[model samples]
Target: MSGPALPPDVIEIRGIRGFGRHGVFEHERADGQEFVVDVRLELDTRPAAASDDLADTVNYGVVAEQVHQAIESDPVDLIETLAQRIADLCLADRRVTATAVTIHKPSAPITVPFDDVVLTVQRRAGEST
Candidate 1:
């Protein structure tokens, strides 16, 4: 016999930008910077595909709003924390089985010139969700 089915559907949102005060440096916190966020949610889409009903699937628009709120809401010291928070928010929806969050800080307080600083966090349902 086959094992239990897995969540195979994926919803992705990328390059969500917002301004937030999140860092360890005094100036970093005082001078808020733009943050870019990306999120991916895994779930089962069969029901939605078959039913053709909005309620049967995860609404990406609502997910985007939630991600925006998480990014622009409170101030945290590290992007890791921010990523975790985003993951938690995504997993809050019972339809989602797993989620991955990537937070990018393009204008980080680093002397050396770099492209960007990014942190990615992934989580599954039933684990601190």
Candidate 2:
């Protein structure tokens, strides 16, 4: 067959925010905090596109659940770590060719009042390989 046609890969999930303790300060983990996550997944969906089957493509719902599970595991030292982990998970999906994971920490325990602390991480498939 001719070179596999480019797949239409698209995935976006927003809001799926959560409240938990993830920080370095002891008080942060003790009192807990809130966090928001926005994720986007990119991949070659040629198979799913042709088959029109969810099973043939990466599922955003499942991705969201996986992210939730990672953040809920326990308090993290830094948002960067969380971002990296989330990105890694996205890349784990065989169908996913690239991913962008952003973690928003509102009401961060900062001395000065700020809107929010956001961390964005982008990763592509086969990064480790």
Candidate 3:
């Protein structure tokens, strides 16, 4: 795949919720919790804008489903890994030059009170971290 000609427009998808059994503690893996994900894709939308066709751009609906599926399917230990998995999902589209994935674990097992726990990951095409 080639790089975008333009600086790349941002397509943001937020509040993607899913139930996942992901954590280090045994109870966390067994009981599970709701995970909220925010995905931002950097891509050139000019092609789709000009052609007025769905095929010319990334279909966010499909992307959301894929992310949701990944959350429900696998049991990973770290949110970092989960974020990377989501980033990989977004970068799967050739049109997406870069992606930012923010994973929110609201019901985390923290001793102290907190509003939320979040992990954000940034990835570019053809790179893994």
RMSD, every candidate, angstroms: 1.8, 2.9, 3.6
Give one digit per residue, the lDDT tens place, for model 1 in 1-129: 999976478999999888888898888789899999999999999999999999999999998988888878899999998899889888888999999899999999889989999888889899864
The local distance difference test score of each candidate is 0.90, 0.83, 0.93
Predicted candidate 2 versus true structure: per-residue lDDT over 16-110, tens digit per residue: 67776889989888887778899989877778879999999888888889888877776779999888888998888787888888999887877
In candidate 1, residue 49 scores what lDDT?
A: 92
Worst 10 residues of 2 by lDDT: 1-10
What's the candidate order when arranged by decreasing lDDT? 3, 1, 2
Tell me the lDDT of model 3 at 112: 100
The C-alpha TM-scores of every prediction are 0.92, 0.87, 0.93
User: On residues 49-124, what C-alpha lDDT tens digit does candidate 3 reach at each position?
Assistant: 9999999999999999999998887899999999988898899899999999999999999999899999999999
Q: Which candidate is the best by TM-score?
A: 3
lDDT of 3 at 111: 97
Better model by lDDT: candidate 1 vs candidate 2: 1
- Is candidate 1 or 2 superior in TM-score? 1
lDDT of 2 at 82: 86
**Which residue window of length 10 is worst by lDDT in model 3?**
2-11
